[model samples]
Target: MGRHSLPDAYAAQDSGDAPPRRRRTVAIATMLVLAVAAGTAAAAQSGLLTFSEPCDDSAVRLTMAASPDIAPAARAVADQARENEVKSDGHCLYVEVVARDSYKVADSLARGDKDPDYEVWLPDSDLWLDRAKGNGDGVPVAPGDSVASSPVALATVPSASRTLGWPGKTYSWAELVATVMRSDEVRLGAADPSRSATGLLALASIGASSDRQGGDSDTRVAEAAKVLAQRMSDGDAHVLETLALDSSGAEAGNPRRNHAVLLSEQAAFAHNADSAGSGKLDLFYPKDGTPLLNYPYALINEPELTTTESRAALRFMTLLRNEDSRRVLAQRGFRTADGTAGTSVIASAGGRKPQPYDASAAAPPSPAALQETLGMWTITVQSARLTTVVDASGSMATLVPGRGQSRMDVTKASLIQALTQFTPNDEIGLWEFATTLDGAKDYRELMPTRRLGDPAKNGGSHREELAAAFAALQPVPNGATGLYDTTLAAYEESLATYVKGKFNALVILTDGSNQDPRSISRSGLIARLEELADPERPVPIIAIAVGPDADREEVAAMAEVTGGGGYQVSDPAEIQAVILQAIMTAGQGGQAAAE
Candidate 1:
């Protein structure tokens, strides 16, 4: 009845309930504790469970690492399949389901740092599938069939939703999020983008939301980044748990209480159910569409799995696709792949409404955007080491007649605006260059590269030092450009002190060609760059040539040698646009990709 009742699933499928332990704020920590305990218990029971007789090696033993939200339903399905004697090549199939965080599973598979030890992974969304494959070329990750799916939504109580003028007024995804972001009246909660799909997808939406034309306009992704940096919790589940635990240190019905969270529709439903079916936790679907958790089933068919184990994993996958499993999954609050409603058997899964199964409902981001956005949230929050070199030649003083400002002034303002894009955890230093400024060296390190919060050589935070140095930057009187010498020094210094994990690079902004007559030739510099550049420790040079007279060709050539890029802007006012583009491409090697 359920299968035929509805037949439309645009995105993916879901499993069972949101784990009870995860209902509290300590969900991530608690899951870790459980994983350690579960792993230990599993190891102790491993020997007898894998083999039939004392010498039996005929059985196929596989570990199934399911996402926490869907693990219980998957486990139930596995148990029933095992009981029904699911077989692969005449061998008994053993599937041991362990609930692991999707982010942990994805990162491990991506880096290959540790053995994931599982034949298959069932993360909440298909986003991880792209991420795992992105880790490396040799990664043998392949997508499989998803059993259940759910889409993310803005979760809030009725009073809070009403207070924000929800029911009477329809809101677009951008409007809803912008309201949450700009208004102090509504307290918003979200999981860390680094570790949660809901959080990652939410940020991606916020990032892409402003790419289009708008009304009552909110700040673009730049503003969204600042808002998210300040508002996000340790993790997604943690934020939800906090709201449930202390209500943000306010009484439950208080007007000033924390109001909303970006969560899955199923999660909001389950939370409402736990609240005695009060429908206190309401789901607000953004009319513009939302990101769905497609339940990507990734099969691990690499050096880790034997031929028999791989076959068994596939067989179990086929078994999970059967009608009975769908029924069981449906009762656990998930729709079947074809968009069937949950059964009445689930008393606490809250109301069942048909979910849209289309791109508009669950817009999957491209692989590049996903990685860049995460990098924006993490590597930048806990980001790279960069050295910014500015050309202070007399030519920089030339006024751009249109904007009624000097090129140097416009460039400085652009640089300062770009500075807001990075967090204090990122390390950056400043340097200025002109002929004969450093006694024939042509460049002087105004600030040493260090974490933005570190006490710099000149005192104050590294950020403070850099800002002050940039502000005090004056065009050297009668100064000539010294591009070649400064670039080589900056490159060598960046290489010598490259931070091991973070993206390490140099940013060069200039308005003219190298003018130091005694500096290294273009030929020699190219040779040295080719000889020293290592793909393993990439230090790209993000170069920008301002004005029509700048050596665009030479700038692009230098950037290419170091696996970076160059941008040329004839107008000084567009320097801000170039700065934003440079920030995105700084250590990204031109295009943003998985690191």
Candidate 2:
């Protein structure tokens, strides 16, 4: 979803900077009018005098969970409201602004098992809202207007900035990242994409820029992710700690310290404001476009909120949009809600005129694109152990409608393309299934799951062996689909061989439903999977139904039992993307469960 706006009726009234005398006169006149109206209504309603009661006895208390980076500004606004006696419907607004990590809050909301203990959530980006409402199963969160904005950029120490030609020369996101990665002197670091919006947005921008440049963009993006993982931090605050302690880049040679980091403009501003001469950072806003961190104000479980609490929360949001509140935020290095920053803010953030920091913000990446990038990042950071089971039924030989290749041929090609996305450390194995493929069994393992970097009996690496195996896949003549039995067998094997700390999964691809009458029924297979599933050691099945004939609902039901999901792809060529997407989704689910 894009940006959200307040309705006309609830929009904040901009009380401009009026002189003290003018404000006093206006307040007096308003009070006189209110007093007359109250006198007229007092005869009918005795509670009209309650508006004059002390705030301590008549206050609407609200707890707000705000992102740590902007918590200070938010807290300041809340404090000002309390000190100034800001009121919502004659009730003093008392907000408790608690600094909280966005990812943690998102996870808690996603679980939906307990109350969030807060009326509102202010995250660094709207992306977290998607995570909170995953699959429409998490606690409901309604997106409101953004309170502040920050652009994602690369920040470096003085020495690194000079070496990279920061002010004098500009580079596209992909080119800049490639330059830093190739350099032996400068080490690039970032907050983990799965946890940091700045990291994820910057990575997405790089991917988009790479795609614009064409040719092997996926490989380039995957390689960049690998490099970034080497120097990754847990979150935005921690990532800043990874930067060099000194401005000269000498301390960065320690290997643990980074010469440059992917960070937000506001973060850079904060860092610069706290640092002295050498500790200051210079920013590089990618020439392509910078992604913005729009801190969206969201209501948590709005329907459950009492009317008073809801009105108070909206009043707080409206106050946050006021001119005075905007000034408070801008003083703390934040941009306005629309991303307009003053010259001083940009300069303090180490941004110059030539850096293109003022360019229109990049179009927000779609949820699917973000999901795929995150999935790619997850696999890149944590190696995967996958057992791929492909259908070799007679129907696989059917020709694809506009393509000359058979269904099997296109699937193999797609699978091979997917292989290139995995690192050498990842473990992958191959299996082909059909009716009685292996003497009384419906599945036969062509290769045991092993690291791609490991050597094979034939002398080359396991990767080469897997590639050959993938190329050799063909439809079994007159064979029928043996989906149910094969899925259970592969899942059992995968779980039994689960490697701790790795993304272990069973990937099954089929073009049709089970046809073997003697095989285990769908319900039996699902029941067995549910019994074998372990929460502590999750092995989610990424089941893909290929073509129109495949039973999507059947596979979805079976997959859901083991905390996995089933997806359908009308074209075999779509398998690679779906596999990564499923892996990302399954990985996130596993993380939530563990939490």
Candidate 3:
């Protein structure tokens, strides 16, 4: 998990600035050829690089959108490449292992806007590969070891073993899954396929395993996704990732955030079987062993490169897989990629050996049977309402690295990008919180409103207003950090008072730590939010913490209470986009529940 901390300021400090123009010197024709080229190439006479594969030998710029979760491993690979442990052409191997969410990775590849110097892209799952192929440019290759893997079995803490079925018998993969689903307490946990690799793979596994009635497996998968989403639509709900369903709730921060992403056997080790713990996490392996996702390593051949840069990247990736690195990973509750490393509890208890993991053995569900008999399905569940909340506090004056722009400037640019995702039927409102109008008290008010009249009808032109607001935003610094207070205010005063009938939401963006506990205590916040929402009629609130020590737990609680989730960004530049997406997604979920 990414440490929820904001970075320091940089060169510029302008609050509202237009998005910086990205200058790519590559010829358009060259990019087209690269897009259309195969993933192999014959021997190169220049001897710069040669591939027996059919990919074109031209400078293929492969951009693997590395999730923050797996950056350590990706950087480790880069380190190995630098030390010659893993070899590749520096000139042609342009790998941009970015910290982009899975959806963004798919979008960039699908649109052909992403030019990777490397041909291979290792996402969390192979679903995006299918979508990419549908767009004509199939995934070129899947390489590298599993970055993270865990047993997808029934898991209970050592403390709860007596209560839960810890030493349960080895049921078949289908039987175990079916059995789990049978229990009200045994809900499945996985990331949403649209946004997460684990989610997509899990959906694909369900589709590939089961038989579809009238619709294709894709349709079935979509339906199952909806069921999973519904189960997770409430604050108290927890989907089993790897831990037991009971292991997650509003009280357990990490578990609650990762309620839906458990590991499959394929990720555990070099081989596969069904051991005791492994049985709990039965593998719903694809018919073709789940199309492998290629994880590529690129050695930057940039003119600005330094010896340290190369060393750092290579050392980091190698470290990720090294025994020490594995230990670090396990300490953070992440599964070790190397099977031999086994499992270790996040916090050791009196020097006891950490939990043991048998990566070699797994209980894979019958691929053919799964293909023949699909169980549940999922859907996009997109249609909903969204509200964007901005923090114009004094701290917003800080700057972010790389872009040499202020946090506020980058926020505006990112918000503008987010505006592009809304539909007319999606009602949107904005609010800002700080000290006071005349420096007396903390307050929040509706800045603007955009009525997305009807999805069945034409959408209004509120995107421009949202974008303008983002651009016009200034650092309205003042008395206190009223994020929680103002959020409550929005739910009570704004949404309840003005936006009466429609679904309501708040995407609160803040860079500073929580200063007003009275406004947002864990218990009080959840209780207050509960009062605003009915069990059947739920609303969502997404909180984004941008600065160091931004009180992620409090924000997460707010999200959890409102049937949504929380996101923390270390980089201020990513705040606008991330927060907006959170708002939009929460709104969508809220609208679905209301309906």
Estimated TM-score for each candidate: 0.73, 0.67, 0.36
Error of 2 at 434 (Å): 20
In the range 1-595, model 1's lDDT, one tens digit per residue, is 0111100121122234332111111001111122235544443222222335531255577889998877888899878756765555456667899999887777777776555578788898777776676537534676665667666677765556656665455556677777777775567777888788988888787666656545312225545655565667776567666353233334664543456777876676557656643345656666666776767566774445655555566566655656677777666666544334443422233222332222245456776888777766653344667899999999999998778888888888777766766777788889999998989689999888888887766567778777777778888889999999899989999888887767777889899998888999887887887887877777888788999879888888888798888889887666656654555555333322235
The 10-residue segment with the lowest total lDDT in model 2: 21-30
Ranking by TM-score: 1, 2, 3
> At residue 542, what lDDT does model 1 achieve?
79
Clashing pairs in 2: none
User: Any runs in candidate 2 off by more than 4 Å, and if so which?
Assistant: 1-50, 247-250, 386-501, 504-595
Report the lDDT tens digits of candidate 3 across residue range 1-595.
2211111110021112221111111111111122212332221211134445532343333444565445555555544433442222223333455665545555665665544443334454334443444355533322223444433332333323322233343333333344445554444555444464444444444544443222333333444444566434221112332343224334333433322233433333211122233222322322223222222232222222333233233323333445454555454334543223232331111101122233242223343332222222211444445567777777777777666777777777777765554455556667766766334445544445555442222343565555666788877755456776677766665444444445455677777655664555756767888777654555666778876747787678777776777888887666545644454345434333433
TM-score of 2: 0.67
Candidate 1: 10-residue stretch with minimal lDDT: 1-10
lDDT of each: 0.67, 0.84, 0.45
Query: What does the lDDT read for residue 413 in candidate 1?
Result: 78
Give Cα distance to truth, residue 325, candidate 3, Å: 58
Q: Supply candidate 2's per-residue lDDT for 403.
A: 98
After superposing candidate 3 on the true structure, give the runs of residues whose Cα lies further than 4 Å from its correct spot.
1-381, 438-441, 452-460, 493-504, 516-523, 576-591
